[model samples]
Target: MSERRTIAIAGGGIGGLIAALALARGGMRVLVYERAARFAPFGAGIQLSPNASRVLYAFGLGKALATAASEPEGLIVRRGRDAQELARGPLKGFMGQRYGAPYLILHRADLHTILRVATEKEIDIDIEMGTAVADFALHKNGVTVLTERDHQLEEHRVAALIGADGLRSTVRARMFGNDQPRPAERTAWRALVPADQLPPEFAANNVGLWLGHDAHLVHYPLRGGSVINVVAVVADAWQATWTGDGWNSPGDKDELAGRFSAWAPQVRDLIDSLPSVTRWALADRKPLRRWGEGAVTLLGDAAHPMLPFLAQGGGMAIEDAMTLGRCLVRGEDVAVALRKYERLRRYRTARVQREARRMDRIYHYSNPMAALRDMVMGARSGQKMIERYNWLYRHKS
Candidate 1:
């Protein structure tokens, strides 16, 4: 008896695209459906820690990723007049020691382009943009994907269905009803301004993180030190929304300053004096109750959406793509393989989501307890603190 061999991935963001590349290269046919009309180069930079970069390197993308990657000397976390030398896990030896891959920090656009282009060149995958997935019907043997057209919609069938679709994934909605997303009591403003445009002090080769009462500001260089990527997160009671490049969403500079008003001079000054910036609320979802059911499964943000505090959002998705691809390729039965993949991934991703939540709170600590925490960090060396996070970085899957 022959089992079905093809797979369908819904969503064309970083996760879906990478999954398409992985599954196709694994000798499985893959078709990726992207709901967006066009891919927008909107996101700021992403810190792809060693854990996820390991997967990227395995895809034979080490060289290409290296070209677009930026390596900061380390992290600098400040709280008011005091600061701490927090952990900066092995950026140097992460890849070689743990998974034979180095950590790569890159602008989201660069990674997107590299993955999309590399997949198109190396795999037999089909990508349809402006195609919104309306729903899916799980049958006895396979699943049928219904896609909405300009005026109508139609169905396409495949043996396996993967919902790499993002945050409010329709596929996940149909599979696991949309529950309340994790709210982190803050808004994150993202924007990319040229390095040359900012104050000379900001162009440093290190990552600057200013932690204040209820907010934090981060700055790092990008594109070979040509442009600076800055992200400011502050407390706001407003509902979390993507607000990405919307018509009413002006890239206002003043609002950026107002949020982190009482922050350290470096942070307040960085915000008020910045040439440009954009802002959006950060939201997350508790780990999905299930990642797979029969022939269909979820991946990346759809399955596990974490706050951006740990800078592992995209990296986790990349890891999900690689792990699922390898699992299916090696499993004996399609159904059995899917189940194993879910079991293996569910625990790890859930842990990461929790860790990210912890980081979000620690980054914005303001009370006396925060001072004690800061004192503890100052007394310890960065490497010692970093060692505590090896569990996160040293993970194989």
Candidate 2:
């Protein structure tokens, strides 16, 4: 590939890998830089709605995803205090039929593996482990990227630079200055339990949502029903006291259990059954008016980090990758193409970020507000509930 067609991507995450694959399919050579020495089995379960699955299938990953993912029958929303069902909505078949792609739930690691393997098979993609994008300089021809590996620095010039380094991204900091992400004042505790270890109700092939006062719980099957992934989010005031090596940190099982002690027996039992859990302090930033400048741009969390209330954090990233690839392949000036990509994606992603925050408020409603929410949700039929988010699910990009 010529220098004009080579793109350097910072961060070997889902967004970065997917961007590489998309760019490769568009006839561009891609180099992916990952700070980790190798991919590790990290993270819990992730819900890939039709919007995300559509892009992955377009990349010929349907078979790989089917092998590792679980297509849940539907989603069940309940009131946490008494486990009262508020709403039930279809997912698997309905989603595929309505939006042309299946909704999938799987371990985060499994999805990462599928993307990694797919990138490895692409001749135009090269992944460099144990390297991090330290800095970059944009010139008339291209961007010169400085990468660090074991305290040594190396420079590579590429037609464009993509900052997919995720939240707290070094690339983003360099591009827009270091504006700290606004904490959402909440913490998510996540764990995976063996299917056989829980009651049948907990192991059912459906996504479960339990909404409470200032907290919520979500669970679904993963890896072909071998394990059940669970996440509990609660209000936290101790962000200043949080100490950890990274966003994901070991959590106190007892502390998590106490948070849900007032809930129903099923909810309490679910918390108690977990052997251990990992936690992340939920946070996001106000949407950016611009994602990049000149030949350098941003993708995924690096561009727009959001709370996980709507389960579209990863989905939006996938959409960004596809949109960016389409924009870049138009043979326009690299900077202009990147700006076009930003224009195409900015509104949709900003809307999702706003919606996720709105959902965070809805899910954590207390008393009268919670009652009104349940009444409104319960009055709607399952199909109606699904249709409410048509804007989100019906998106092709």
Candidate 3:
């Protein structure tokens, strides 16, 4: 009988955990090395589009995910002055029904728990917490992942090394050298409020978006309508950090109101209502020259960290895990699998990168003429607008 191959997954974020779970369940011996000491499953909310939710449903995490998630009626894009919705469409679960899944917005910790619980059920996943990969050496047969402590170096010649590690991936950095990630010209301030804390208008289940001059806001419910998560974005003069301190940070409520003072009243009311908020600058990397080298290859944010305008960052990473597993499971030779995986993912992710960058201008449009152009955008009509995203939101592979 052929022996099941061994796989090493670096980084324990959503991508790493999901890849580990997928591979282990596929009958591969798996060991996941997370740099953190323990996993508390913390962080704010994230949106799971159909492209991603289908995979979660396949994992049987739908009920758990749904409990902590909410599907907005639609995405309401508004013009700043009067808060008049510039466009409205069926974007959440409404769009998901057509695509075979749902768009779910849930607290990050909840989804983490769901994945962790599912993977721990029957999989022998050796999760080495508080362990960071110091370096690596790759060969034809397998790869070695090194950490700071000497006692845990269990070297094995595996079939492949999956770098599900994130944007600042140590594996990719060791192989490709440290190229600087470009700073996106915007920063984000995120906050969450108890449902009752929100006014009656916001208490209703809906996702609200207020598009302004060089800024925008996204708000929706989470934890089965118990809490509302608000993310405000604005163009800034400086670049921001990637790793946040975890959880929402305290901010000046009046200052928060000041930033959006010119925005529509509904937006101001929401910001003004928040007792506290956390702010961070948004950062992104340009596309890598290539994503794979020998037996070591990249996945998720390590391979592509686009702008967050599409709300697909986590969803795309989940898609990466599924697509990569599909490629790897198709063959006996691991190198062939890795190559196929990279080929399948690059084009789609690159196009997403471009589209995300294009949205930067859309959110930051300050000129009157730019407003007119968008006010009558032809892309809003017909299936073309929805169809254009089909290549992304509708793909199963």
Candidate 4:
């Protein structure tokens, strides 16, 4: 019997590219439609925890990633006001030995470039940039993808559709009407500065998280330790008036400095020294019981958008791509394959989503509650702290 081999993937981000590569490796053809004119190195840095790293290694990009990525020695959780270390967890050799893959931190652009290059090399994958998927229709045999480019609407038929389109996914909206992303009541600012541009303190080869009242700051080395990627997430009064396009909007360093004015002097100095910053409002959709209908389904943020507190958003999306590809290759029917994929991923992603939200609250605790939280965190040994997240980092799919 002929296999349902051609798949349409909306979005060209990490998830979409990974899906394309994974599906192509399964001997299926892939078409990726991206709205960007080109796949430029965009966004700040992202951490690839052991769970996601395992998937990438399985995809055979281990060597490339190892060379391009910075493996942080460990994570240091600190009090945002005083820079006092609350807890520490190993990530370098410890994670590799424990989880069979090392934890990596790298520029988002570097990761995307690696995946995009890998996808381009596959014979069955084709990518179209500047083409946005406007809508899609599900049919008995396949899906018809409607895209808009240069004000022209075009349609293409495929055996299936994968909505890896990210947080504000059009395919997701069209599939389940009335579903819109809700602001997570947080805004983030990111800046990547050259290592030489910052003080020796910021050049540490470890991931640092400073948790404060209603705010948190994360920083780690990126691009093999040549740069430091810093992110600040704070409770903001900004309304949801943003139209989604303003994400990654150019931000003023002064405005960000004002927000972190009362933070530790080190943090304030870091913010002041940033050459520039980009601001984004974090938004997420409520988890859905099921992510697809017929031969179409959602992946990544489209399927489950969550808070960034857990640092597993990208990891979960990577796992989704691998699992979906494997299901498609194993199942005899397209719809059945997608259903199995959804079933396998829905619970896991939802749990991560909930955990992320919990982390958001935990990281923003204040005063007496904050002191109690610190004691609890400090009570755990580094190994125990890492073990606590073993369920998350040790996940295979």
- The numbered model that scores best in TM-score is 2
Candidate 4 ranges beyond 4 A from true positions: 1-3
Worst 10 residues of 4 by lDDT: 237-246
- Please provide, for model 2 over 240-354, each residue's C-alpha lDDT reduced to its tens digit, 9 standing for 90 to 100: 5777666667889999988999999999998888989988888999999999899999999999999999999999999999999999998999999999999999999999999
Q: Pick the candidate with the highest lDDT.
A: 2
Considering summed lDDT, which 10 consecutive residues are worst modelled in model 3?
239-248
Using lDDT as the measure, name the better of candidate 2 and candidate 4.
2
TM-score, candidate number 4: 0.96
Per-prediction TM-score, please? 0.92, 0.98, 0.91, 0.96
- What lDDT does model 3 reach? 0.76
lDDT of 1: 0.76
Q: What is the C-alpha RMSD of each candidate to the true structure, in Å?
A: 2.7, 1.0, 2.8, 1.6
Q: Residue 253 error for model 3, in Å?
A: 3.5
lDDT of 4: 0.87
Best to worst by lDDT, what's the order?
A: 2, 4, 1, 3
lDDT, residue 275, candidate 4: 90
RMSD of model 4 against the true structure: 1.6
**Residue clash pairs of candidate 2:** none
lDDT of 1 at 333: 68
Between candidates 2 and 3, which one is better according to lDDT?
Answer: 2
TM-score of 3: 0.91
